[model samples]
Target: MIEPELTRCVASFHPGATGVTGAAKLSGGASQETWTFDIVHPSGNVGAILRRAPPGYGAAPGRAAGLDAEATLMQLAHDAGLPSPKVMHVLTPEDGLGRGFIMARVEGETIARKILRDEEFAKARPMLARQLGRVIAGIHGLPQAKLPQLRSLTATKEIEDLAREYQSFNWPRPVFELALRWLRDHDPGPSSEVTLVHGDFRHGNLIIGPDGVRAVLDWELAHTGDPMEDIGWICVNSWRFGEIDKPVGGFGTREDLFAGYAEAGRKVDPDRVMFWEVMGTLRWGVMCCGMMQRFRLGPDHSMERAMIGRRASETEIDLLRLLAPRGK
Candidate 1:
C-alpha cells in the first residue's frame, strides 16, 4: 500500500533517487509503523527507513514526542555527531505517505541476544559501556535553543506518572508498592543541569556493530530532565539480559561509564545515578505489566508483550538486590 506513494516520495526529495524498492514493514502498530526500503538511484542503491503514524492517527497522543519532533531530534543528533541516522526528508502533505520522516538506514544488529552472545560483537562489549556514556553526555549537551518544545520531566513527576499507570491496571503489586514508596522517599529533587534525556537508551534502541554502537534509535520518549536518568536506565537489570554481574548493559562497570562521561567534561552524581537505577528497574517492571494489559485488551495481539509481562517478577529480585542487598 505504501510503495507507489513511497516511490514518488523519495523521488521528490532525493535528486538522484529514481524510485524505491523492496519495501517491507519492520515493526509497529496500526497507528505507528516502521518500514525498510532501498532508494533506487542512478549511481547506487541507498538503504532508507521510514517511521510514520499513518495519516489519521493525528498528533502523537500521550507522551510521544511526535514524528516531527523525532525528525528534528535525529537531525540534531546527527549534526552533533552522536551516532544517529541522518534524517533525509520529512513527509509533506503532497507525499501522501502519512506523517513521518525518512532517515538513512544504518546497518547493525539491534537484537540484544545476538549482540550479547555473537562473536562479532565480542570485542565491542568491553568498550560499549564507556562509549555509551560519552554519547549520553553529548545528548545532554545539545544546545537548548534549537530543541523543539518537549515535556519537562522531574524525578518526582516521573514517579507519579509510573504510579498512575500502574494503578490504572487495578492489579496490586506489593513489590511495585514498595518501589513507589522508596522512590518517593529517595527523590533527588531537581537536577542541577536540565538537558535532553534520551527517554529510552537501552538494548533494542542501540544499533551495535562489530566496532561499537553505530546508532541510537527511537526518540519518541525524549524529554527535558535529568541526564543521569539515561545512565540509570541502561544499567537496569532487565537490560542486562542474563549478565547480572556486568551492570552496564552487561558489558562493563559503572566506573567505565563514569570515566567516559567525565571525559565529556560532565560531573557524575553517584547518588542520582543509583536512584535512577532503582527507578529504571521499577519502571521496567511496571512497563511489563502495562504491555501485558495492552495484549489482553487491545488490537496488539503480540505474544512478545505477554512474554515480557511474565518477566515482571525479575524486577522484584532486582529491587531486593538494590534496596535490601545481602552481604556478598
Candidate 2:
C-alpha cells in the first residue's frame, strides 16, 4: 500500500507530480532514514531521494550539522556548480514527512572497492583523486554568508575529543596511545584559513561516474575547520580499499591532488595535511571501537558491528606505518 502521507507530500512539492511510486527505504538507523522513490508525473517518472529523521526523532546527535543545514549546503553547492544533487524540496510539518529534504537522484557508484576495481569505473579511477581535490576546493570556497550554522573545530579540539571518546571505550591499545601522543606533539594548531571541512570526504561518501566524481555525498560530518582535514581524510589508508600505494583514495598521487587544489587557487599545506592524516587514522579506529561498543551494549547487535570492531587493528597497523615506518 502506498503511504498516503508520502503521496500527498510529493504532490505538494513536485510540480505536476500526481503522486509518488515505488517508495523504498534505502537505508536507515535509529535517528535517520533514506528513501528512494519516483515522482509519478505526466511527462515521466522523475527519480528522487528522501532523507528524513522520521517523527519523534528530534535534534541531530553530537557533531552533526543537522538536516536543515545539510539541505542548505546541498542547495548552495548545486548553485555554485559543484557536482551535487539538486535540492528539490525540504519537508515541512504540513507534508507529514518528518524533517529532511528531497533531492534529485544523481546516479553513480559510491563503493570505493567497486570504483577502484570495477571495469566500468576504470576510466574514472585514474582521474578521481585530482578531480576530487578540485571538488573539495569548491566546497571549501563556498560563500561563508550562505553557510548554515555549524560547529567550529580545530586540530587541538579534535584531538582532545578523540582522546576522550577513546578513553570512554576503556579499551587500551598501545599503538593508539602512540598515535595520540604523536598528534599532540605534531598538532598544527589552528588553520590560517578556516573553511568548510567535509568532515568525512573519503571513499564511502563519494559518488563516482565514468566521467569522474559525480557527487560528494553525506554532509553529516561537515563542519567549519581546517580545509586540509578534508584532504587528509581522503588519504586515510582504510578508504584506500587495499590499494595502499595510491594515497588519494587508492586512485592517484598526492602530487596530483595538490596540483588540482593549486589550479583551483588554494594553497596546500603539506605539513598540516599530514598531521590531520594521522589524526584521521586514529579517529577511524576509535569509531570502529565505538561501533563494537554499541553492538555489545544494545540496539544494533549485529555481526557487522562486531566485525568492524576487529578492523580497529587495521588502523592500529596503519598508525604504526605512519608514525614508525619500518623501512623509511
Candidate 3:
C-alpha cells in the first residue's frame, strides 16, 4: 500500500488527485512494476500511470539516471516534435514508489499482434511505419551536448562500447560469442556523431491512432548512441513476430520505412541498420542468458528461465542466416 504522505505528495503534484482511488497494478511489464490509477478532481476524473523499478534480474545501476532520465528523454522527444505523452513529474527514491515518473495515460493501439491482426488498423499500417521512421529520425537529430543527463547514465564512450560490454559478460551461448566478435571486427567506423536513441523502439513501443501516432511509450532504455542502434533494434526479427518478409515494424517493408526516413531528413543505410539488427538479436540473446544465469549452477531453477534459455538458439540461428548469405 502507498503511504498517505506519498499519496498526498502525488496529489499535490497534480490538481486532479483530489479523490485518487482504484490504483491497481498493470500487467505485461517484465522489468518494472506499473500501476494505473483513477484520479477524481472537483472538475472531473483522469487516468494516469506510474512506473517503478523494483529489485529484479535486469535492473541496471544509477538510480537517478535510470527511469528519471527516461522521463527527461520523453520530454525531449515531445519537444523534438514526436508524438509522446506529456511527462508530469519524476519521483525520487524518497517518494516511496521507487524510481519512477507520472505521465498522461495515452490512449492508442500499442500491441503489435493486435495491430497486425485487427481489421481497424489494416490501412493505417503503412502510415504507421512512415511515422515511426520520422520519429526515429527526429530522435537522432537531437543535439548531443544538450543531453548531459543521458551522457552521464551511459556505460560506454561510444555505442560500440555496448558490444564490448556484452563481450565481457560470461555468456553460455556460442552464437553470442561469434556475434560479439563480428560486431567488434566490423566496428561501423568510429562515429563522433551521437544522438538520442529510444533503446527499444518497435511496433509495440509506439501508440498508433487514426489521425497518426498518439504517443511513443516506454523510455526505460533511452540512451545516447549511434542512431542506427535504434534503427536496427526495431528491425530485429524478434519484434517481427514471425513475419519474416514484413520488415517495417511488422507491417511494411524496410524500403518504405527507409524512404520515409529519407524524407524526414535522415539518411537510411541498409547495411548499418542490418548490423544493429544482428546486434539486437545477439544482445537480447545474451540478456536472456543473464536472466537464467542464477540457475546455471543449480538449486535456483525456474521453468521461465529455462524457457528463455531456449530462445537464444533461435536468435543465434536468425543471426547466422542474416550474416551468411547464399554464397558467403
Candidate 4:
C-alpha cells in the first residue's frame, strides 16, 4: 500500500503534484536515513531524495550539522548557482515523515574508484580538481548573514580534539604521537579569514559524472573554519584511491586547484594547506582506530568494521610519507 501520509505531505507543498511513487530506502543507520522517491505529478515524475532522523531520533549526534542546517546549506548553495540539489520540501510533523527534508535529486557517480578508473570519467577527471576548487570557493563565499549556525573550528582546536580522541584509544602508535607533536608545533592558529569549511569534501561526498563534478553532497560535517581544510582534506591519500602522484583528489594538480581558487578571487595558502594535510591524515588514522574499537566492543559489530581496523596501517604509511618521507 502507498504511504498515504507521505503522499499528502508532498501534495501540500509540491504544486501540481498528485502523489509520490517508487519510495525506497537509499541508505541510513539507526538514527538517520536517506530515501529516494518520485513525486508523481501531471507534468512529470520528479526524482527526489529524503534525508531524515525519523521520528524518535531527536537531534543529530556530536559535531553533526543537524538535518535542518543541512537543508539550509543545500538551498543556499543551490541559490548561489553551485552544483547542488534544490531543496524541495522540509518535512513537518503533519507529514508523518519525521524531521528531515526532500530535495530534487542529481544523478552522478560518487565512487572514487570509478571516477578515477572508468573511461566514462576520463575527460571529467582532469577537470575535477579545478572545478571542485571553484565550487569550494563558492561554498566558502556564501553570504554569512544568510547561513545557519554551525560549529566553528580552528586548527589549534582541531589538533587538540584529534589528540584527545587518539589518546582515548590508549593504543600507542609512535608515528601518531610524532604526527600529533608536529601538528602542535606547526599549528597555524587562527586563520586571517575563516569561512565555511565542507569538513568532508572528498571522494564519496562528491558526485562525479562524464562532464565533471555534477554535485557536492553530504553536509553533515559542514562547519565554519579555515577554507584550506577543504583543500587539504581532498588531497588526503585515502581519497586518492591508489593514484598517489596526483595530489588533488587523484585527478589533477594542486597548482590547478589553487589556480581555480585564485581565479574565483580567493587566495590559497599552500603552507596552511600542507599543515592541514598532515592533520587530516592523522584524523583518518584515528578514525580507523575508532572503528576497530567499535568492532571489538559494540552492538553493531561487523566484518566491514573489522576490515577497516586493519586499514589503520594504511594511514600509518601515509602519515610516514607526510612526516618522515624517504628521500628519492
lDDT of each: 0.93, 0.90, 0.71, 0.90
RMSD (Å) of each candidate, 1 decimal: 1.1, 1.0, 3.8, 1.2
Q: Judged by lDDT relative to the true structure, which candidate is superior, 3 or 4?
A: 4
Pairs with backbone N, CA or C atoms under 3 Å apart (clashes), candidate 4: none
The CA-based lDDT of model 3 is what?
A: 0.71
Instruction: Pick out the ten consecutive residues of candidate 1 with the lowest summed lDDT.
Output: 55-64
Sort every candidate by lDDT, greatest first.
1, 2, 4, 3
lDDT of 1 at 104: 98
Q: Which ten residues in a row have the lowest lDDT in candidate 2?
A: 1-10
Candidate 4 displacement at residue 320 in angstroms: 0.6
The model with the greatest lDDT is 1
TM-score of each prediction: 0.98, 0.98, 0.84, 0.98
Residue clash pairs of candidate 1: none
> Model 3 over residues 22-56: C-alpha lDDT tens digits?
77787534456777776667777777777677543
Cα TM-score of candidate 2: 0.98
Q: How close is candidate 4 to the true structure, as a TM-score?
A: 0.98
List the candidate 4 regions with Cα displacement exceeding 4 Å.
none
Estimate, for each residue in 44-67, the C-alpha lDDT of model 1 and write its tens digit.
999999999998789887888999
lDDT of 4 by residue, 171-256 (tens): 88999999999999998889999898889999998888899887888999999999999999988999888899999888989999
